[model samples]
Target chain A: MSNDIIDGILEAIRLLFTFDRELWGIIEVSFRVSLTSTFLAALVALPIGSFIGLREFRGKKTLSNLINTFMGFPPVVMGLIIYLLLSRSGPLGSLGLLYSTSAMIFAQFFLAVPIITGTAKAAIESVDPTLKETILSLGASERQLWWELIKDSKKSIIAGFLVAFGQAISEVGAVMIVGGNIRWETRTFTTSIVLNTRMGEFGMAIALGVLLISIAFIVNYGLTRLQARGG
Target chain B: MNLLKVSNLYKEYYKEDKSSINVLSGINFSINKGECFVIIGPNGSGKTTLLRILGLLEPPTKGQILYYNEDLCNISRYKKVQYRRKFSFVRQKPIVRNTSVFNNIAYGLRVRGMKWEEYINDVNDIIKLVDLKGLEKKNARSLSGGEMQRVAIAMNFVFSPDLYLLDEVSANLDPMNVKLLDDFITKIKQDKEKTIIMSTHDPLEAIKFGDRIAVLNNGQITQLGTPNEIFTAPKDEFTALFVGYENILSGTAEMDLKSGLTIIKINNLTIVASEQVEGEVKVCIRPESIGISKNPPSNVSYRNNFKGNIEDIRDLGNTCHLIINCQSERFLATITKLSLNNLELAINSEIFINFKATDVKIL
Candidate 1:
C-alpha cells in the first residue's frame, strides 16, 4: 500500500534469493538447537508416554492429569524455571550453562518434551485394542507387543515430533531468557526476528519467517509421502 | 494324556453399576492330544469365554486349567506367554493388521524369533494353501471380509502351534471361505499330535469337526461326549431341545410289559419306545430313524407305523427333511434325495412313516 512496504517486500525476496549469510547463520542455530532438543525430548518422552498409555497401575490417572497439565504449560514459565536452575548462585549454577546454547537447549527441551509425551500417549491410546490381542495371540512377548504398538502409532508420534520441532524452532521467550540471544552463538530465528523487528528491519524478519515456513512445508511434504507409501 | 484338563472354571464381568454378570460357571472338560474338541452352544452360552480362557488370553475367576497336569491358573504373565507359544488362537471376527498379507501371515514366526529366510516359504505355502497366493502383497485391511478371514486363518496356520484354539472362525464367513478354512482345519487335524479346540454355535460344524462335543448352555456344560452319543442320548430337556435334530415330543407314558415296551400317548397318537420310563416322558426320535415308504412297512414287528401325508419338503442338499402330518400329529423324517425322487414324494404326498421301538428314546 505504501512505497516503504513495497521496498521492504522486494528486499525480503532479494535477501532470500541472495542467501544472506546473516540469515543463514540464524537458520543454522535455530535448526541445531530445536532439532537437538526435539530429538532428545522424543527419546525420553516416547517411553514414558507409551508406558502410561498402555499399562493400568496405581496413580495412572494422576500421572495422566499431570502430563496433560504440562502439555499446555507456558513456554515463558519454562524459560524462567530453566533460567533459575542454571543461573549463578542457584542450585545448578556450577555447570556454567547460563547465557549459552546449552542453556537455550535446556529451556527448549523442557518446553518440547511435555507436548511430545502428551501426543504420544494419546496416539498409543487410540490404537485398536483388538490388534493388541492379535499381537499377543501370535506369542509376542511384552517387549514385542509394545514395539508393535509403537509401530502402529508411528504416524501420530512423528506428527507430535513435528509439532514439538515447530514450537522449539519458533521459540523466543525461553531462548532469550536463558541464552541472552547472543549473535553467532545463541541467536535463533525467533529471537533474531524479534530483534530485527525492534530495529525496523522488517524485511529481514519477514524473509526469515518465510524460510522457516518453507522448511516446515518440506518436512510435512516428505512425511505425507511416507504415510501414503506406508499404507 | 490329556493336553488340557479344565476343572471348574468360572468367569464374571462387573458392569458399571457394580453388578456382576456370570459368563461361565463350573465349566469342566478334558481334551486329549490331537483331538478335535468342539464346544457348541447358542450365542451368549459361554463358548467364547471358555475358548479365551483355554487360549490363556484371560484368567478364570475360579478353578484351574491344568496344562499337561500342571496348573496354569496361577502362572505368571511371562510364563503364560511361554505356554501361549504352544497354541494358536483364531478370533471370531477376522481382525488383521494394516500391513501386507505376507507380514500378517508371518507374524507368528516373527514373534518366535524365526528368521525371514526360515519363515518366508512357510508363509508363502500357507498363502497358497488358503487360496491367497497372489494376494500376499496386498494390504490385509483392504481385503474383503471373506478374504480377511482367509488371511486370519493363514496367520495362525503357518506357524503350526501344538494346539489350535479357533473361536467361531467360520461363524460369519462365506461358504467358499468356510470350505477353504474347514479343509485347512481338516489338514491340521490330520496331524495326530496337534490338538484343536474349536467352538461354534452351528450344529453342522460341531458334527463335522468335533471328535468330542461339549454342549454348553446357561454358563454350564449340559453334556459332553462323542457327536453320536451327544446327539442320540442328550441327558436333559435343554440338550434335547438345543440339539433338536431329534424330534422331541412330550407325552404320557405307560409301561406295556405285555409287548415288552413302553407306550407313549401324544394327543390321540400312540407310540412305543424300547425303554420302560413311566408317567410324563419325552419321546425322542432321530429324524434319520424314521422310515418313509409308499406302503406301510409290514412284518417289521418292532416297528411303529403311521399313515401320514407329507406336509413340508425341505431339500437339504443331498438329504431331504420331510415334515409329515399323521392324524394331526407332526413328525420330522429325513430321507435321501434319491428316495424322494424314487417315491415321487412332494408336499401333500400320502406316505407311511415308521420307526422301530428301539429307535425311540424315553427321557
Candidate 2:
C-alpha cells in the first residue's frame, strides 16, 4: 500500500508539471463558477450586511438571528432545495437552468450569501462607536458616512469575501447534486477528485486535491498580504 | 446678541425593561459669540450629553435649541448637517482614523471637498500648532494617548469653525500636552470670530479658560456666572466644595453698627465679612486667601486672625496646604513653597492664620 501511494504521488506531480489539459480544464470550470457566485453574492450581501450592522430598527434582532442561522446551513441540504426549485414542474423550472453551470452557480451563490453577510455584519459592527460619532460631528453627509465606514472596515470586508470564496470553491455536494457533474461543463476540482477516486484513478484524484490546496493557499496568502498592507 | 440659546433642554434614556433614567432636565443657558463658556461638572453629570446636543449630534428629549433665532430642533437633516459645519466638537476620547496622521488631521477639509493645494498650508500650520510636526506621515493609531489627542485637536483646529465644542479634551493629557492645548485654546479665544464651549471637572481650568462658567451637578445647573463670581460666591454647598473652598461653615450673622461689617459667629470663632447679611447663612473662605505666618504681624491690615496649631500639612507640588486648628475649628490655608519653607511650618507647630474681611464670602 505504501509503495502504491508513493507511485500515485509521483505520477500526480508529473501530471501537474506537464500542464495536463483535462486537469486545467477542470480547474478553470471550478474557478469560473465559484468566482461568479462570489462576486454576485458580494454585490447583494455587502450593502444589506452594512445596513443591518449600522442601523437599529424594529425586528433587527430577529433578522440578524435569521442570517446567523443561515450561516450554518448545510451544503447538501441547500443543494436539494435548489434542485427542487430548478427542477421541471417546479416554480422556477420555466428558466430551464437545471444540470447546468448556471444552476451550479445558483447553488453556490445561495451557499455563500449568508456566510458573507453574517461575517460582514460582524466586521462592520466591530468598528469603534467613537469613530462613528467623530465622523458625524465633523458633518459627514450620508454618502460620506457610508464611504468612511466602508473604507474603515475594508480589511474585514475583504476577509469576509475571502471566506465566502473559500467556501464556494471547496464545496462539492451542492454542485454535484445541482450540476450533475457534467463532463467539461460543470466538472470542478472537488467533484472531479471524487469522480476520479471512484474510478480508481488515484493519481488524478491526488493531483486535483493538491491543486485545490495550492489554490486555497495562494488565495489566502494574497488576501492576508492585502489586509496587512491595509493595516 | 446671543449666538446660541438652549431653553428647557431635557434628556432621558430608556432601558430595555421600560425604565427611564433622567440624565439632564430643565437646562437653560445662552452663549454669546466670541465667548468661552465652560461647564464644570462631576462624572456622570450629563456634560457630554449637553455638548452632543449643542454639536447637533444628539437631539434633546424635550426642548428647543435656537441658533441665531432659528430653531435647530426643527431643521431638516440637510440643514442640520450644514449647521454642524459651522462648529467643531472634540470628544473626550481622541478618535482618529486608522490612516496617516496628516490624513486624519485633513479629514474635515477633505470631507468638505477642499483641494489639497488649498488646505496643505493650513494643515501643516495646524500640525505645528499641535506639536505633531514630525509624526505627520506616521499612522495615527500608533501614537500615544496625548499625541492622539493633539491630533484630534489639530483636526478640529484646522477647520477654524465659528463655534468649537470640546468635552473634557484634556482629561488624560500630560502636563506638557495640557499646556499645549491651553495655549491653543487661548490663541483661539483671542479670535473674535470664534466661540467656544468646553466642559471640565477642573476648577482651575474652568477659571483659566471660561468667560462664563456653569456649575452642573446631578443633571442641573446650580449656578452660572463669571469665574470670579463662581469662585468667590458659590450658590450652594455642592458648588462650594466643587470650587475648592475648604472652609464652609454655617453661622449666624448680624450687621456690626460700628464697623459696617457682618459679624458671623461659628463654633466660637467670630468671622467678619465685607458683605452685609442678617440671620442664618453659610460662609465660604478659600484656602489660598488665608495667610500663614510663624509670627503675628503688628501693623498689617488683616482683620481676621487666629492663633492655632498646625494639625496637618499637605504638599501640593509648589504649594503647601496647612490645616490650622483653632479652638476646635479647622481652617485650611494654602501657601507657596517659599512661604512654607521660610516659616519652617510643621505639624503640631504654632502658627497665626490671617485673612482680610473681604476674602470671606457670605452665601
Candidate 3:
C-alpha cells in the first residue's frame, strides 16, 4: 500500500507538469461538468432562495421544511432514481443520455441545488428586518429591494455557491452511477480516484485524493474569511 | 386638509401556535401640514407600530389611511410606491449600512438617482446641520451610539421628505446630545416647516419639544391635546398617574358662597381650591406647588395652611420631599433640606404645609 501511494504521488506530479493530452482532456471535462452544474444551480437557486427568504405565506414553514429535508437526501438514492428513469426500458431511455457526461452533470446539478438554495435562503433571511423597512421607506421599488438584499447578502450567496460547487465536485456515488465512470469522459476527480484505486493505480488515486482535499480546504477557508468579514 | 389621517387603525399579531394577540386596536389621529405632532407612551404602547403603519412600511390590519383625502388603501400598487416616497422613517437604533458615514448619509440620495455632485453637496450640508463635523469618511459601524443617531438624523433630514417619522430617537442619547436633537428638531420646524411626527417616552421631551402631545395606552389614544392641557387636565386616572405622580387625593367639595371659594374635605383635612367644582372629585397638586414650614406662619393669611406631622422626608438633589400627615390625610410637598435643618425637622417632626388655593386643580 505504501509503495503504491508513493508511485501514485510521483505519477500525479509527472502528469501535472507534462500537460499530457489525456490528462488535460480529463481535467477539462471535470471543470466543464462542475462549473456548469454549479452555475445552473446558482441561477435557479438565487431567486428561489430570495423569495423564500423575503416573503411569508401560509405554507412557508412546510416549504422550508421540505427543502431542508431534501438537503439531506442521499446522493446514491438520487442516482438510483435518476438511473432508473433514464435507463433503457425507462421513461426517458430513448434520449440516450444515461452513462454520458450530460447525465453526470444532471445528477450533480440536482444534488447541488438544494444546498445552494437552503444556505442562501438562511443567509438572506437573517438580515435585520429593519434594514428591509428602511430601504422600502426610501422609496425602493420591489425589484430594487430585491437587488439590495442580494447585494447585502453577496458574501453568503457566494459561500452558498462555493458549498454547492464543493459538494458537486467531490461527489462520486451519483456521478459514477449516472456517467458509468467512463475513462476520459465522465470520470471526475472523485470518480477517477475510486476507479484508479480499483485498478491498482494507487499513486494516481492518492494524488487525486490529496488534490481534492486541498481544493476543498482552500474554498472553505476563503468562504469562512468572507463570512467573518460580512458578519 | 390634514396631510395624514389615520382612522380606525388596528394591528394584530398571530403567533406560530395560531393564537392571535391584538397589539394595536382602533388607533385614530390626524396631523396637519407643518405640525410637530408627538406621541408619548410607556413601553409596549404601540408607538413604533403606529409609526411603521404611518410610514407605509406595513399595512394596518383594518383602517383607512388617507393622504390628502385619497384613500391609501385604495391606491394602485405603483401609485402606493409613488405616494410612499413622500415620507421617510428614521429608526431609533439607526440601521446604517456598513459603510463610510458619508456613504451612509449619501445612500438615500444615490437611490433617488441624484447626480453625484449634487448628492455630495447635500450630504455635507446635512452633516454640518447635525453638527457631525470632520467625521464624514469614518466607518459608520465603528461610530458610537450617539454619533450613529446623529448620522441617521442627518440622513433622513437631507432628503427633506414631506413627512418625517422618528421613533424614540433620543432614548439612548445623553443630556447634551438630547439637547442637540432638540435643537435639530426645532430648527427643522422653524426652517422647513415640514410635518414632523415622532414618538418619545420622556415626559420632559414631550413637554419641551412636542407642539401637541398624544398619550397612548393599551393601543388607544388616551389623551390628545396641547402639552399644557394634557399635563393640567388629564381626562382619566391613568393619564393623571402617567403624566406625573402628582399627588392625587379624593375629596368632597363644599362651596363657600361668601368667599367664592370651594373647600374640599378629604376625611378630616380641609383644602381650598379656586375652582368651584361641586360634589365629589379628585384633586391633583404637584409637590413643588405646595410649600412646607417648620412652624405655622403668624402673619400670612393664606386660605390653605395645615399643621401636620412629617411622615417621610426624601432628598432628591437640591429638593427635599416632605410627606406630611395632616389629621387623616397625607399631603406631599417639595421643600429644601435647609428649611428642614433650620426647623430641626426629622422623622415625625411637626410641620406646616401651606400653598395658595389656585395651586390645586379639582379633576
Candidate 4:
C-alpha cells in the first residue's frame, strides 16, 4: 500500500511536468468556463454591487441580506437548479443548454455572482463618503461619481473577483450535474479528478488536484498582496 | 446685485431610532456678486449644513436657494449638478482623491471638459501657488493633513468656479499651512469677479477675510453684520460669546438717573452699560476690552473701574487671561504677554480692571 502511494505520487509529478494532454484539456475547460462565467458575472455584479452600496431605496437592506445569504448557497443546489431549468421539458429547455458547457457555465454563474456581488458591495461601501461628496463637489455627474467610487475601490473589487474565480474554478458538483462531465466537452479539473480517482487513474486525479490547489494558492496570494499594500 | 440668496433654509437629519436633529432652521441670507461672505460659528453650529445647501450638495428641508434668480434648492439633481459646477466647497478636513496631487488638482478642470494640454499649465500654476510644486507626482492620499488640505484648495481654486465655498479650511492647519492658505485666500480675493463664502470658528479669520459675517449658533443665524459690527457689538448672548466675549454676567438693571446709564447689578457689583435696557439682562464684555492696570489709571470718572486681585493667570500662548476677583465678583481680563511680562503680574497680584460703558454689550 505504501509503495502504491509513492508510485502514484511519482506518476502525478510526471503527468504534471510532462504536460499530459488529457490533464491539460481538463484544466483548459475548467479555466475557460470559470473565466468566461466570472467575467460575465462581474459585468452584471459590479453595477449591482455599487448600486446596492451607494443608493438609498426601499427594500435595500433586504436585497443586501439576500445577496449575502446567497453567497453561502450550496453548489449542488445551484447545479440542480440549472439542471432543472435547462433540462428537456423544463421552462428553459427550448434553448437546449442541458448537459453542455453552457449549462455548466450557467451553474457557475449562479455560484459566482453572489460571491462577487456580495464582496463588491462590501468593498464599494467601505469607500469614504467624503470622497463621494468631494467628487460630487467637483461637479461630477451621477455616473461620474459612481465611476470614481468604483475606481476608488478597484483593489478590493479585484480581490473579490479573484475570490469568486477561485470559488467558481474549484466548484465540482454544479458543473457535474449540469455538464454531465462529458469527456472532451464539459469535463473540468475537479470533475476530471473525481472521475479519474474513481476509475483508478490516480496520477491524473492527483495531478488535477495539485493544479487546482496551485490556482487557489495564486488567487489567495493575490488577495494577500492586495491587502498588504493597504489597498 | 445679489448672486445667491438662501431663503428660510431648513435642514433636518433623521437617525436610526427615528429621532431627528434640526441642523439648520429658517436660515436667510444672500450673497452679493463679487462679495466675500463669511459664516462664523463654533463647531456643529450648522455651518457645514448651510454651506452644503448653498453648494447645491443638499436640498434644504423647507426652503429655496436662488442662484441668479433660479431656485437651486428645489431643482432636479441634474440641474443642481449643472449649477454646482459653478461652485466648489472646500471641506474642513479635505478628503482627497486616491491619486497623484496633480491629478487631484486637475480633476475639476478635467470634469469641466478641459483637455490635458489646456489645463496642465493651470494645474501646475495652482500646484505652485499652493506651495506643493515638487509634490505633484506624490499620491495625494499619502500626504499629511496639511498637504491634502492644500490639494483640496488648489483643486477648487484651479477650477476658478464662480463661487468658492470653504468650510473651515484653516481651522486645523498648522501655522505655516495657515499662512499658505491665507495667502491663497488673499490671492483669490484679488480676483474681483470671483465670489467666495467661507465658514470658520475663528473670529479673527472672520474679521480678517470677511466683507460681511454671519454668526450661526444652534441651527440659527444669531447675527449678521460686517465683522467690525459683529465683533464690536454681538446682538445676543450666543453671538456675544461666539465673537470672543468671555465675560458673561446676568444682572438686573434700571436707568441710573444720576449717572444717566443703565446700571446692571451683577452679584452685588454695579456695572454700567451704554444700552438703555431696564430689566434683567446679561452683560457681555470681551476680555480684551477690559484694560488691566497695575494701578487705577487717573480719570476713573470716564470708565467703569474696579480694583481687583489677580486670582489666576491663564497663559494662553500669545495672550494671558487674568481671572480677577474684585470685591468677590470675578471678571476675566485678557492682556498681551508683553504686558503680562512688563507689569510683572502674577497670581494674587493686585490690579485694576476697567472698560468703557459702551464696551459692555447688553444682551
What lDDT is reached at residue A86 by model 1?
92
RMSD of 2: 10.8
Worst 10 residues of 3 chain A by lDDT: A19-28
Give one digit per residue, the lDDT tens place, for model 4 in B182-228: 87777777788889999999876776678899999989998998764
- In the range B195-260, model 2's lDDT, one tens digit per residue, is 999999988778667889999998899999877567645678799788864466667999999999
Query: Model 4 chain A — which ten-residue stretch has the worst lDDT?
Result: A1-10
Q: Write the per-residue lDDT of candidate 2 for residues A11-83, one digit (tens) a residue.
A: 8998899999888889899999999999999999998898788777899999999999998889999999999
Error of 1 at B169 (Å): 0.9
Instruction: Give the TM-score of chain A, superposed on the true chain A, for all candidates in the order listed.
Output: 0.93, 0.95, 0.93, 0.96
Model 2 lDDT vs. the true structure?
A: 0.88
After TM-score superposition, what is the CA distance of residue A213 in candidate 4 from its true location, in Å? 1.3
Tens-place lDDT per residue, model 3, B36-109, is 89999999999999999888877888999888998886776678777667788888887777678998788777
Task: Rank the models by TM-score, top first.
Answer: 4, 1, 2, 3
**Which pairs, if any, clash in model 2?**
none
Residue pairs clashing in model 3 are A8-A203, A8-A204
Candidate that beats the other on DockQ, 3 or 4, i.e. the better one: 4
Docking class for candidate 2: medium
What TM-score number comes out for model 1?
A: 0.79
lDDT for position B199 in model 1: 91
Question: Best by lDDT, which number?
Answer: 2
